[model samples]
Target chain A: MIQDIMTVAETAKLIEAGNVLLLAGDEAVLRQLPKGNWIGGTIPYFISHAEGGLATRDRIFVTDVTGVAQSVEIVERDANGLAKVYAEGPQEGFSVVIIPALSKAHLSFALNAPNYKDFGVRPLIGWISGVHLDDLGKVTPKVFNGVTGNALEEGAVVLQATLKPGKVAEVGIVNLFEQGGGDILTFPADGFSAKEVLVNGEKRNFAAYIVKNKLDTRLPLVADYYGALVNISFQGIDEVEGEVKFYAPVFTGIRYKHAKPVADYGEAFKACLENKCQLSEDRVVFSCNCILNYLYSGLEGKKTDPFVGPITFGEIAYQLLNQTLVYLEVHDV
Target chain B: MDVPSMSRPQWTDLVTGKKTYQLKFLAAKILLGRLVHSVKENPTPANIKSCIEQVYNVYAKNAGSPSVQEDLTTIFG
Candidate 1:
């Protein structure tokens, strides 16, 4: 539940003692730390006590989990085998993960991790670490496992915390967008690629469908997955292939029944931060917001109140998400 | 497509629809990402100074966060 920034030297002390910690900081700072009982990723942007957003290269955002981590596991650089970490996660409590941004393992875990949900695995909460100013799309994101001191550029590192016997951890997602009135669109096949999708059952090229309807590309495609709002944010519409791609893969079987229109991001986000939160700000143990929301909502210099953490490239709450906020709350049950 | 080549203000100019649509989309997208963090735990001058510099660096590189830019001006100016 610890959320605060510390100097690289101070952070090194936490890592040196083999204390469970989750970290976000500059590459140089993260690289210098003495690896111990911790897992971390690279990111300069964060939601600190300061208004809006702040970036730091000198300090590291440390989430002290020294007493909380009952056990930890590191998932090696296996694309398809990434989900195995969750299978090996703490069964009695919850697990958190840190995956390198834009890695094959990140996409692989996103596509397959949801399967573990049905098996009744412990809640999975974490984010994809990335670099700032990634406009040219040249990103080199990394994840760290202090236990092994592995500063991995691929695969992932997971920390499965078996809360104190009387303690419980619950995962929550806060999304403001709902299905808007539009042609029901869904891809014919799964994976990140979609050439033609059923637009009310009539096949149409995904890009052409978007262009034809003049859809607000900023708004994500939302599907109600058993009452949970699953969002598939658009990456771009390739004119050459006439295909539509999403930040996270949208499985074909999900049958995206609705298009969630984009709302006034500032107001919607403010409200979600204030009212939609199931757990009070004081009770929030760990939370992360999608980078899409951070960029789309103009979050710089704005306060999201109690909901704060690293603004991540992607969010994982059992499944990958876009333009949404995911949080972990521990309750003494 | 030539985002890095364009100046921050030029890229942000698209947000008003006065510039290219692609740049506008990119600008709006980048500007919207807010990094909300609480520094009450360690509000030391050094921390705040580094945070300001970081905010400036992010904005200077991307030129999307005008609010942060204004904050930087207020702090340093």
Candidate 2:
């Protein structure tokens, strides 16, 4: 797996050599690459081999999938067309997707992907493309269909790759936060922003509740989807409007609790990865950790060894996830 | 923990929240999650049957796993 940052010329050389690549970099640098078998999204931040967490616009982070993929196909889909994503994917392989942040496709996928046809039936992993923090309002995040060299700001760019026979792809997530011993919270509806919540079956103003309890907004609300511990990170609390915004949607019937506080984010990640993931580094072909984790955990100079890729705005294991590390492993049957 | 053997009625009961059991596979979890939501909204026999058929088809596709195949037989038989 060639997961490393390279100069524009180096990346173009790989693309020109027929490498099937997943790329992340600045829009300008990604635009400079030669059209080939690749899919890219704009993000200047990455966790590179040489640097623990680096932000650079001049280089591109590349994951060469040519070694494991027998054949690769790239497709672009808008919000309404994303329902066929899983059904259209290869039966024996996995799909990697990149949707620009704040795009209609991103919001649609985040809220409705679980209801999509054949959801979670196959391995699907990817991240949400984003601009640098400084460029949040000034620029839009974009995805590239490398074959056409078209940069799209509205839809998703998907790379569906069929694995070689005997090689199977599996998706897994590592989340450091778990349900804390607090009031069980449920929302009035499914949405990214909530003005009302049920606290222990009692109605309460969502933002007011957080403010009254002096809750730490950095810690997300955690829900157990079956056995998987999923997170909904807090984006912000609107005091005057009495609304609480989240990075991911909170469903109506789901039970969620504030995450247990972590004394040390870096050590917590290291220990969680050590205990939960005994992954052989080589088997992990692709992976991405959330940018919130990178920022909150102070990972700028720290290494989360054995896992490296773009530090993204959001993550996808099968559905949109927040504050989680999603990885795809190729195993021999 | 042993895999709980469930009959079709028991499966419906579980989906309708009459009983609860920890699902052992991702396929079961994903299918049951949607079914549970569906039956909660409308507990009609046709709706429940449609959910069951969907589950059977998805489980059949993943019958490559011995455990899934075993569960399928245990539930449908």
Candidate 3:
């Protein structure tokens, strides 16, 4: 896998060379690339091979898929058009999608992806595009369609890549946090923000409940989706409004518990990878970790070896996830 | 376990937590989660069948695999 940070000139060369690529960089840098077979999302933060976690706008992180992909098709879809995302993807291949942060497409995908037609039938993996933390409200995040050289802020740009014969793509996640032995939390409806929640079967103000328990907001609410431990990270709480906002929507009928505290995020993440993930480093085509992990764990210059890519706003395995590391690997059968 | 011999009520029991069966596969778990939520609201035959068809759609690519076939039989039969 050709995954690394390169200068804009070098990235443009790869694009011109017709290599199927998934590029991540500053919006300005990505806008400088030539048109070709690729899709790009704006983000300055990344966990690079040379430097573990660093933010740079001058270079782009490129994942060259020319070797693994037999053919690649780029599609741009709005919130409603995203309904066809999985249904339209190559039957035998995987998709890489990039939706701008805070866009309608992002909200729609996070809240309704589970109900999408053929949802989870095929491997769909990607990240939510975001600007520099400093530029959060100043500049909107954008995704680029290399085919048309168009950047979009309201929809998603997807790369539907058909893999080589006998090769299969698999998406997996590494979540360091587990459900703690805390009160069972349930919400009344599916949404990203909530004012009320059921705590151990009792109705309570969601924000007040968190404040009363002195919960560490950095840790996400973990739920067991079958064997998969899904995470919904905390975005913020409005004390005046008595509302708690989450990076991903919390669904009704799902039981959630505050995640157990981690003594050291860097060490725990590395250990989880070594123990839980049996990955062939070379076979890993792409991987990305949540930006929340980067901020909370102070990942600057710290390496989560064997897995590295963009430090994104949110991650997507089959659906939107938060405070987790998601990766895609190809295996020959 | 002769899962195919189980009745709709038994399957509902498993999903609704009246019974238990360890599901294998993320897709199965996800589909079952949706089914459980839907059945709780309205367990009409049409709704149950629709949810069952979704589970089958996800496993359509693996329809030939013995484990997938068994799971389909266990959940839908």
Candidate 4:
């Protein structure tokens, strides 16, 4: 029934099937509207039922965000030739985008071209959040879309689309060739890292060096599990006790910290406390796995550098963060 | 409410309007990318340098991230 909604269109096959079209809006609007065959496939109706009925009662509402009337439509044809317009709209806000078929196969492409990743992937969820319904009165497969916001501009490339765990799948910015596919970029991290770690005979406090230079705002680690908590927790995994190689942050020599020899994690902590260790803007980065290995095994046997030995997810995170102020300047995106 | 005076701003700061929150998110992800790439790739001084800079630049694009207001408050406060 044509109600308070700004616009709506029903399927044409139903009308072509010769079913008498009778519709009512809410309980008290009191007028059963006329139903007719599709024009170019769209069942176009004006917004009168919404004039006084529940429409004015604030049932279904659609607000314009870009400060313009957004177009809504029910397209019957997938391609251009059959391009049947089942419905069209400037639908009222707070309304349900009701669909005819509630199936996993139900599909609709957005014309807005939104990018959620740009808004931190949080605000973008609004585009994909809605109830999908079908003629059989059953809920279809829920789809969840993880779109990289940058590619979701007015006419950018669509990146990803898919179904989610629940019956509420959503897809956003179907394109993203410009953002990642173009240039280099940078950002910040909470920097979950240990400031100081004690190997066998040496102790280095990367944290104090960072704090000394007022760069510790993002650093978040005290005595981490690597150099200090190793002896007690891990025992057999002592593969990284020899020739440890640290991947220090070059920082263009901005903040530099001196690497030293200490007794253990305790000594590293004590040295930091006693010296009021200052964060060095010039810094280097190393893996805690190596320190953890040394802490557990000590210098009993020859050790090798894992930085050159193996790779893990954590190592990747560290390297990328080290050069966060980077760029590859591809202007095309 | 009267509309605020600062309606329009430049693009540089506008892109990173939420720099603080965005950086952290990108930082973690960059690190992941680095780890994955380092497998067959040998990380040396020149190599590490470019990798560091590349990852940094890539992640910096996520302008509006969590805790960014706090970071900006610290930087400009």
- lDDT score for residue A226 of model 3: 64
Worst 10 residues of 1 chain B by lDDT: B27-36
lDDT of each: 0.66, 0.85, 0.86, 0.21
Q: Where does the lowest 10-residue lDDT sum fall in candidate 4 chain A?
A: A169-178
Stretches of candidate 2 off by over 4 Å are: B1-34, B37-47, B54-59, B62-77
lDDT minimum window of 10 residues, candidate 4 chain B: B2-11
lDDT of 1 by residue, A1-333 (tens): 567778888888877777778898877888888857778898887877654566667888888765555665544445665656545656556778888877888888877765432222345688999887653266588888877778888888777777666655566788877888777776666677688898888888888878877888778888765345678888888978888888888765454744565567667777766674445665577888877777877777776666767888898876678878888766554
Candidates sorted on DockQ, descending: 3, 2, 4, 1
In candidate 2, the residue pairs with backbone N, CA or C atoms under 3 Å apart (3 or more residues apart, or in different chains) clash, namely: none
TM-score, chain A only, candidate 4, equals 0.15
- For model 1, residues B1-77, the per-residue Cα lDDT tens digits are 11232234532332222332221111112222211121233455464444334333333432322232333343233
lDDT of 4 by residue, B1-71 (tens): 11112222211222322232222232323232332234225545455444434333323322232223233
Measured as a fraction from 0 to 1, the native contacts recovered by model 4 come to 0.02
Q: Give per-residue CA lDDT, model 3, range A172-237, as digits (tens).
A: 788899999999999999999999999999999999998988999999999887657899999899
Tell me the docking grade of candidate 1: incorrect
TM-score of each: 0.76, 0.91, 0.92, 0.19
Q: Stretches of candidate 4 above 4 Å error?
A: A1-63, A67-333, B1-51, B62-77
In terms of lDDT, the poorest run of 10 residues in model 3 chain A is A270-279
